[model samples]
Target: MKKNILGLLIVSLLLVFVAVNLLTGNEAAPASSLEIQQAESKVEEETVKVNTEVNAEIPYAKDFTLSNLQGEEVSLSDYKGQIVILNFWATWCPPCKEEMPHMQSFYEKQDDIEIVAVNLTSMDVGLEKVKQFVDDYGLTFPVLLDEEDIVGQQYGIITIPTTYIIDQEGRVFQEIVGAVDEQMLEEMINALKSYDE
Candidate 1:
């Protein structure tokens, strides 16, 4: 009789414990889709913040004044409020030859951007050769002459056709080491505009 009473007491305690848990709603539940999306969005925003920090290291483009093909002085600061494509190229570089037409096409199509094509004249044969190349390609963009290689040294142009994408705020957005086509230039401009927005 005493054993039966102990078993009944244990059963009753277990039942009470379950009833309390059910009443308080202390049960595990799955997360909703909306909560998951919010968490993912937060992670994406944090990733963008980290990328922006990395870009801050190469903050601004270096300013320099050089003479264009017209023998007029042109400074990088002249296009401060515009998107500047600071292209470093030489006359003998095959890749430079490859991109001049595309650069010209992009320049004519887009009025909102500036192409500051700096010819590495010091490395090339002469100013006459640079002029002839520009004429042959019909590149109407401002072709600045790096006659003394001052700007080349400043920009660290170890490779031919090194293009720096400078934003409207004079920040170096990107550096394209080789040749770039018209489509690439368009996409880069659009991306920079979107980033600014």
Candidate 2:
């Protein structure tokens, strides 16, 4: 198989975009803005401190176990042999909300891929709010709870709606830091399929 060059380049550009987005805070919809309302609703801006430092090099996606709404534990290893779209998001993020329909639609149509919408549970308003968000969005994909932010910290998730597409071999195939539409998602998955062939 060819090296995952497309994935690498996308990740590189996304990192640069994220840095610029943070410094300017002028983007129409920065990924950080996804949960901004929740932040404002709870903490005053004066009390909010932004962490400028992040792990410059994100390691390979690590295996983690998180609970779903059904209270069952799900792990990355369990999805072995299938492609996984591991997404980190929160209920209060607008961009995350913007992207979920596309993700859910793709999940419903795709037979060979698994979509795991990992909710930043620690940052959400409450469990009831997450349930409401899921019900409102009509999402059928497995929604994992990162209640302690452990997986987010491990993945160096500085932004909401951060997505890592893991290939069937359990390798990180691609990473997108912002919202993605259906066409883009389909193209990426198709490219991965072609690579495997």
Candidate 3:
């Protein structure tokens, strides 16, 4: 009698497991080609904001001229009619290092947007390190040296890898604080394009 009861319990558990799998099988199934393509093309609307308190009251980015690695003066106003990704970073920062590749990839694919990376020289190692980093990463975007942290202060950069998305009209559209991948950059630019339209 004990053996029979044990057998019945085992069969009941197997039945329950099979029932659950049958109910959830569709979710586990592989997506179709069209479904995969749609998923890849569609950008999901989600919250990507960081340091909201700092950017809440700020409407437009303050124009400032900073010398690039090549010692050429580049100003925020120079990119007024274009979307700008203004990033503040330091040489020793891990996240900043991680983000540079993605930034470079996105910059290469884009023709209308501009990426201005501001190296916080005062907080970073030095000018030589910054140059080495740019060369090692093969970055073509304009890298400005904030030797005195003046631009960093103007942009309210308390953390490394702080990126601000400026609209075509020089409005501060979004402020992302952290490492962002190429997909995230593409989504943000696509959203900005929609907003511009």
**Which predicted model would earn the best TM-score?**
3
Predicted candidate 2 versus true structure: per-residue lDDT over 86-130, tens digit per residue? 999999899999999999899999899999999999988999999
lDDT by residue (7-92, candidate 1, tens digit) is 99999999999999999999878879998999898996674444333264557999999998878999999999999999999999
Could you give me the TM-score of model 3 versus the true structure? Answer: 0.72
Q: Per-model C-alpha lDDT, please?
A: 0.87, 0.84, 0.86
Comparing 1 with 3 on TM-score, the higher-scoring candidate is 3
Q: How much is 29 displaced in model 2, in angstroms?
A: 29
RMSD in Å for model 1: 13.8
Between candidates 1 and 3, name the one with more favorable lDDT: 1
For model 2, the superposed segments whose C-alpha errors exceed 4 Å read: 1-60
Mark the regions of model 3 whose C-alpha exceeds 4 Å error after superposition: 1-45, 48-58
The best-first sequence of candidates by TM-score reads: 3, 1, 2
lDDT of 2: 0.84
> Candidate 3 residues 1-197, lDDT tens each?
99999999999999998898889874577889999877766633324323222334449889999999878898989999999999999889999999999999999998899999999999988789999999999999999999998988887889889998888989887888889889888877776777667
5: Cα error in model 3, Å: 51
TM per candidate = 0.72, 0.70, 0.72
Which candidate comes out best when scored by lDDT? 1
Clashing residue pairs for model 2: 34-93
Which window of ten consecutive residues has the lowest lDDT sum in model 3? Answer: 45-54
